[model samples]
Target: MERRIISAGFVQDALAALTRRGLDPAPALAAAGIASGNERVSNLQYGRMWLAITAMIEDEFFGLAARPMRPGSFNLLCQAVLHARTLEHALRRALSFLRVVLDDPAGELLQKDGLAEIVLTDRDRPRLAFAYRAYWLILMGVMCWLVGRRIPLMRVDFACAAPENRSDYHQFFGAPVHFDQPRSRLVFAAHYLSLTPIRSEKALQGFLRAAPANILIRYRHDQGLSARLRARLRATPPEDWPTLDRLAADLRLSPATLRRRLRAEGQSLSAIRDEIRQAQARIMLAEGRLKVAEIAARLGYAEPSAFHRAFLKWTGTSPAAYRTDKQG
Candidate 1:
């Protein structure tokens, strides 16, 4: 989660907006601890940069339009939706609240063909892909938080032209994304509408403190063995990573049975372990808070050279080279 795993396209888009507004993006980037020349920024860095930019412009919407969404608009919206009895009520109320505050991009919930769609419509200006991405992310994120799971997206449609990185859309929505559509919308199972909100006012406080960070990073706690395993791995320190046998025991399965289950799920324990380590390494390196040797040790590597070899194999670049390239 600490890694600079986000696509550089987002940063570029934000910078472009700053430039268009005749504002210097350097200060925001610096405040986020992001090197202006870097290709990508960590999620935390992006959140910081976003907050800084919004503060400077006094618009939480990032100057995507003429009218500014005041800085505390999101907080107010969350408060309004918090007392809803069901997910449907929460979304409908939240969207209604937003419509009153913002002049464009009003939202409506439509039900048809066993699917519930949250459609967002805006004044027909050339849309920034990043802006649309952010819009969809917030809506989907808040809904998921309410239902206590990652809602399986049935369809995601955008009004703008397809982005150059089309493949990324699939990963973002966990469903194929269609562009050049009539309006921006997210479709999912209608059943989710009746699901009660699992979050309470106490929980909302923590969510508000983190702001967009909790939403921007999509964490699926609902399905997928890979996601569950990834969550467990993330919760445990790299140095304390359990052995396959121990992991199986923890999951209440024999080692052989666990192996079979993993293979059936189209994954392997070793592969998942490697992924966790690589992700952690990338984040730590991006943060630049630890030395290479220190990171290697923290990741349970016996020697720095072993860590270097593993990193090179995983990333096709030496650790130092990867860090330098990403850090600019």
Candidate 2:
């Protein structure tokens, strides 16, 4: 699967926040491998830039309406919730911790009518756009990490009026979103609250290192059958990939049924195969550990020319050119 990319508007927001505090964002942007003020950035670049900016300013919340969430506050927050018996307990504990740290805007988790609702409320009406985005993302990310599944959202309600980039929020939240509502809240199935936290301290050590990058992928297996199929393809080696008929058999469905299912999901077996192959090719090229011929063989391509053609088709450049661009 292709890695997610972030809109440059988010970086612009971060820059504005830094400028307000008399800080320079150029160095951080450079460190994050972004050379231009373009409209899109790879998710990895966004994560790097976000961490660098927050670290330089010593404020994890990026000086958004809330008090400066001091450096290391996120680690502390993660530690505080790591051992909860269930996601419900962990979520409440996390909200309580944030409330104590940032006072005015309080986080609440409520379960009623077979739905779990997570809300961020502020009687003082603090600057909410940035803060709300971060808080909701944090809550959803942490909850999903705890349960080892992407909890499908039913609806996301925002108290503030919709912004011009409202569609972006809908994409990120993966659900119906209502603006100009009485409160900012996320709604999902209540049963997720009962799922125990599957992460151990050891597991969390690696996860924390990845941080926001892990959370930003817009789609996950629970979102649809296509995502699940992509996950399966990703897990298997390219040389060992199953044929369409074999894959369908393994999935316990007929080839015709599988095709129909994938079509309904706006996907096809060939596209999924190509995505996985392209992703692998890029990774191998970026690593620079293998020659083009070797990489082609590993990807099950019978000839180097075929691999080169596919690479050009997928990336609009030759494999060698792509590698050189990435390495430089």
Tens digits of lDDT, candidate 1, 253-289: 8999987866544457776677668767877888888
lDDT of 1 at 31: 89
Off by over 4 Å in 2: 1-4, 218-328
Q: How many backbone clashes does candidate 2 have?
A: 0
lDDT of 2: 0.75
User: How much does candidate 2 score in TM-score?
Assistant: 0.67
Residue 44, model 2: lDDT of: 77
What lDDT does each candidate get? 0.74, 0.75
Candidate 1 achieves a global lDDT of 0.74
